[model samples]
Target: MQGRVIYQEHIDVLIAGGGVGGAAAAAALSQLGLRILIIEPGPAQGRRLAGELIHPPGIDGLCRLGLLSDRSMPGSPVKGFAIFPADKDDPASSVTLRYGEKPGTRHLGRAIEHRILKDHLLETVQRFPGVTAWIGARVTRIEENPDGSFTAMVRSNDGEEIRIRPRLFLGADGPMSRVRKLIGISHETRRYSGMMGIEVEDTHLPNNGYGNIFLNSAGVAYAYAIGGGRARVMFEVLKGADSKESIKTHLGLFPPLFRLDIERVLATSKPLAAANFCIVPNASVRGNAALVGDARGCCHPLTASGITAAVKDALILRDALSESNLDIATALRRYSRRCGRLELTRRTLAEELREAFLAQTPEALLLRECIFSYWRTSDKACVRSMALLSTVDTSIFSLATQYGTVALQAFRLLPRWFFEKTVVDWHRGVLRLVHKSLAFQYAAIRQWLY
Candidate 1:
């Protein structure tokens, strides 16, 4: 059976899923005077719980592309992050890590609502010349031509089908991307945890203008202001835990004032729930087709680096195309090569951070203490950590160095271990640390070289 045909169009690029990555790519590629068509499957008013807090690098990328402006986008300014240690009742025990302490970093991050941010981005991209977007449309089928191009069939909300033939096809349809599957790319997704988010009004944070992270036995809980008199609190729900009960259990971990606010919001509204998972694609590019944003890969939100990584992907793709002089094959290869290491670092860092913060095992708890000690003792350590977290520095060498430093800090507990524990336990801890340190270095070096 054939569907109703609305119109046929020829474009330079066909972007699937007009979300953050697609909008960013359209805005960036429109500068090259290319005709770009963006088809979004979801309606314009669709509200999905997704990334709302963006790091400094993402903020800079959006501003650089002229898609985001302080005056145009109404959101809260996040200077940095404030981390409260587990079992610590004193507010004074919290450690604050500020942005811009490192060179070449933005002074503040932004925390807009997810729906508002997506709408603003879509609106901004649609205003760009040579860019067309279909809000309730989706690419249903993609056919590859022998000459290295794609013919995509898009169906609108009303069932009207439009055929598009473009020189380049980008898959930005997110973690469960249909385009990625259509392009025959295999990906592995691992479920880490679950997250529940609630928005509260007039909440007071221990440190204003910073994201507050409260460490707990279950998982990590995050609280930060999103906009005018409004704040967002997210609780990480471990596997097999009751979502509502988990959130209620974590609420008391926050400061008294913030705890009261969360209770009030809980009484008034239901929290939005989303799964936290990571996807690692076998490959990001094949022939003239490519994957960007979460379509390429994603990590747990413990790092809050999803939006930042997506923006960077767009910028890197733009640079790759320009450097390759718009040659589709060469540009895709360049993009793949440049993004491979960054994705590896992001995924690995997110996994390690989550493991350390959650601290289910003895070694993990030790590593967590060492991390806190490192942050407390050295201002430079905080800057470096923030730099890595902000995505301003993606070098695996820097990551290895930081890991080694943290590992060495763990070694300082050797004497205490010998005094407080059995000799066998001390020996086992030493062996485990050594094994982990070596394995991490080996992986980092191999990944860097490859």
Candidate 2:
């Protein structure tokens, strides 16, 4: 519409990268009476963070954007998830914390646990009459014109580069985005420090219906349920925790995990956190462009909510654009302001939690002990903590405050030494026997009596 009429008769919006974020934005922009183009780098081969525990807010956004309904027309639905203290030594010692509770705005977020789930999303994109999704096309470069339009240089899988000009071009590309750099945006690296995300499929864990968190004293791992009775095991190796043997030992701790014996899954998964933690600044519309999803930034995967965070950004971006006229600057600005506030809270809390889990001190040990006791007993505290992570609290700060209050209350109610012995000296002497007795009862109730 402004620079060259190469893309369309009247190019309105162009979304680069057709992952969840790009597709969601494209669908939203269509409601604004704009023709959309979604340029995805690959076909079904699009590489994404495969393990997703799509939370309630993310599911609600999908419904609102007309992307999915009750049955996940495109993807699948998961009831909820469970969190384990990843640093713990024993699988039986896991605290199965479920994010969804009974009827409320806060329910268990359905998880999309595999790469094939992308097929459902891709199918929906294919059927969207108002949008064009050019799959297997790689976007190599972008040119922001003086008058505020964009010229994207996209290369087909066959090495043919085509230039298309669109009024508002978005880079929904993953963490390594050229679009942000072209705009000269410098990102501040946060807490990625020294960690890597390795996703592998394990077939023996259908009972891991939701995402299962595993945090040993060394690092943390997350397992999300996928199709075909499969689950993805993501091991986040912390600083100085990067030996193949260490990973093997951690996997050995879970008897259920070992039964699968799927070593190939570990060998293939990509490591994202190997890069320094950074959030590109001024990623919003510099002139008439938008940077959505990980092209903007990503936090640690400890929350298992990165994919949802990206989708939420798209939803908010769409809302901002649709509600107001296409003054691209204002719209993109809104996307930045809203997403920053929203993601910052999530990321900050996750970093804090990760740090605490990674710490090896008496206070940290005490906290870990308390959490594990609940894991052993399946208590109210576990339920409440799960609720807080999903959508119940809404405010991250508030959630922490509430959890602290509950911990204090639980301490006052239960005998201090009992919790201390069971969690603190968990593997030795009377505490070991005490936990053995209590753990047996828990196993029975969870297995038989519910």
Q: What is the alpha-carbon lDDT of model 2 when measured against the actual structure?
A: 0.61
After superposition, the stretches of candidate 1 with alpha carbons farther than 4 Å from their true spots are 1-9, 44-46, 89-91, 102-105, 422-427
Q: Evaluate model 1: give its TM-score.
A: 0.94
List the global CA lDDT of all models. Answer: 0.83, 0.61
For every model shown, what is its TM-score relative to the native structure? 0.94, 0.76
Global lDDT of model 1: 0.83
Off by over 4 Å in 2: 1-9, 44-49, 72-77, 86-91, 100-106, 156-161, 190-207, 239-242, 256-283, 366-384, 391-393, 403-450
User: RMSD of each candidate?
Assistant: 2.2, 9.3
Best by lDDT: 1
- List model 2 lDDT by residue over 367-446, tens digit each: 45554554455456666665545534445445445434433433532466575555343233234324433543453344
Error of 1 at 431 (Å): 3.0
Model 2 weakest 10-residue run by lDDT: 425-434
Clash tally, candidates in order: 0, 12
